[model samples]
Target: MDMPRPYRSVLYIPASKERALDKARSLDVDAIIFDLEDAVTPDAKVEARDTLKAALKEGGYGARAKIIRLNGLDSAWGREDAEAMKDAEADAFLLPKVSSAADVEALAAIIGKDKDIWAMIETPMGVMKAEEIAAHPQMKGFVAGTNDLAKELNCRFRADRLPMITSLSMMLLAAKAHGIVAIDGVYNQFKDDEGLAAECAQGRDMGFEGKTLIHPAQVAVCNEAFSPSAEEIDLAERQIAAFEETEASGQGVAVVDGKIVENLHVETARKILALAEAVSAR
Candidate 1:
């Protein structure tokens, strides 16, 4: 099983703000979402696209993935946003409020299949139809638009997020089923490490590829949460060694920490080591 790139900390930077874009170049984040949707007011949306295009052309973001969040196709800005960014230097374009496969298809039509898309599963309808969306050929990722989903569901923002679990799981299942990246929504309490850490743990345990972020302060915590710990890395290394030895002896199994290590376990162990190396290289 091949693991995709780690999106452990994807920080959203407003494309309209020059300072924010410049500052993001230095942030210790795996990916940067150059947002032109919710972060920009109508007056700034058009100009922000130009600013982002220029910034990407200037090229100081290093190895961090660059994703541009476009406004909805139904909105006034979305089409033009796509048109403006089609030639921009970005790994992918994130579509906000994607309801079904058609929504992704529409964006794909405009942007062309050359670039990929990350759908924002924020609405009730979107959650229900997540499977079709994830199945889209150009759809590469899913972002749990938790804040918007909560608002749409008329649910309280509880720490446990009991009300939103079903929807989140649905999106996760769809993404994983389609071999796409599954990213958890933002933690608004950027200044609260304890709260952020807890939420990051929840997302990681839920098998999210990473957590979408709103602030630079949240990166370290988010990165740590998704990363394989030292102990985990050590165990993964030992598991690989043991499994290799077994293979050399023509056996199909090994044991690590007294647990059965089979082909499945070796695959998982390899992913852990790969993720650790990716984090270090980032």
Candidate 2:
């Protein structure tokens, strides 16, 4: 089996900003999304792509997954953005406001079938067709675009995110089903570390591999929330040891802290340990 890649904290850095791109190299982030979409003004779109391409060529980001978020094909500069950076040193290309599998296919057509595609599930139609998008052969991830979804759905923002749960679940389900990464939306309040931590905890509980961040300051909290805690790491180890003992004895289950450790639990426990290792390696 392939070792799981940790996506605990994915930060959006505007491609046009040279300083921000350089600063991102040192952040405690698992991935960097070099944004060419909403973060850039229309006039600077082409310039941003070139800047990002040049920056990537100069290379210093290390092992952090470098994802480039492209403008949608519906936009004037989207095709050009993709074409210009198709050969850039990026881990993946994020398609903004992806509404269906066809959107993914269009990017594939432009960038060729070998490239990885990550979809932004922020529209009502995008959430509705999430399964189709996730099933695309080139699809590698789904990022929740909660801000846009709320705007489109005409829903009020709540700390509990009650309005966005259904949509979130749909996108998450699609990603989990297809064995792709699912990232939670940005927690807009940059200065409110408490709120960011709370939301990050909520997202981690909801099975999101990571939270997409808007600011560099948010990286520490997001990584802490998503990573396996010491207690969790201990428990995972115990579960694996106990389960292995039981299996050697020709049993199908084991007990750890009064809980049953079946094959599925062992599988989860091993993944937790693997993820911890990945985070440590990072």
Candidate 3:
């Protein structure tokens, strides 16, 4: 399966801040979410939309994939946000609080079929209906909204993330079932480098394609977690070589370094190689 570019470190920038938008060009993030929602104040929504429009047209995001996170579908900013970014070179509309397939279809109608929809499954309803939400044809991915999820669930935040783990895992399963990407929520402790790395590792182990990042300081940690390690690439190459050598005989599985390699393992190896290529290009 071909993975879409891994947005392991998706940086959120308030669209109203012109300087921050300009500075993002030098950052090493995989994607940028120019916010028209939570990051911008109600009074600044219009200005932020304008800034995002101009920025995308001017190529402010550099090589990072650009996503415009619109306000909720019920809000006034949502429709206008889609309009302003309609012609802008945004990769997708990061639809906030999408609780069902209808919500995705609604955005798909506005954004058109070619442009994709990245849904934020933040609410209790969203978590309960994750599989249905991810079943949309144009749904490209799901980004976990743990902060909002905690708020909705009325749970206190903790390092263990026990309250949010089930919801997060549900998203990963749903995304995988539908062949869509699943990304973890941001680590709020931006200054705690070690803590952030641990959270990234946890997300990676849970099968998340990447993590939503809040600050530039978190970029390297997120990238490192999602990127293929040297050992992983080496193992992948060895598996491929082993499988190729037995192609004429057509064995059910190949063995490399005493480790059995199956077709499923080969798929994982291919994905790692693809990630390596994307990271190198970035």
Which candidate tops TM-score? 2
Ranking by TM-score: 2, 1, 3
| lDDT-best of 2 and 3 | 2
**Residues 185-266, candidate 2, lDDT per residue (tens digit)?**
9999999999999999999999999999999999999999999999999999999999889878995679999999888988
Which runs in model 1 stand beyond 4 Å of their true positions?
A: 1-3, 251-253
| Clashing pairs for predicted structure model 1, backbone only | none
Clashes of each: 0, 0, 0
What do the candidate models score in CA lDDT, each in turn?
A: 0.93, 0.93, 0.86
Worst lDDT run of 10 residues, candidate 1, spans: 1-10
- Model 3 gets an lDDT of 0.86
In model 3, how large is the Cα lDDT of residue 191? 98
Model 1, 63-162: lDDT tens digits are 8999999999999989999988998999999999999999999999998988899999999999999999999999999999999999999999988888
RMSD of each: 1.4, 1.0, 1.8
Find the 10 residues in a row with the least total lDDT in model 2. Answer: 1-10
lDDT of 3 by residue, 1-282 (tens): 554586888889888999989998899999888888999998988888778778778885667888888998789788878877777788888999988899888877787888888999999899889999888888888999989999999998888888888888888889999998888999999999999989999988888878898889899988998888999999988887787777757766688988887777887788888888878877
Stretches off by above 4 angstroms in model 3 are 1-4, 249-253
Cα deviation of 259, candidate 2, in Å: 1.4
Per-model TM-score, in order, reads 0.97, 0.98, 0.94
Stretch of 10 with least lDDT, candidate 3: 1-10
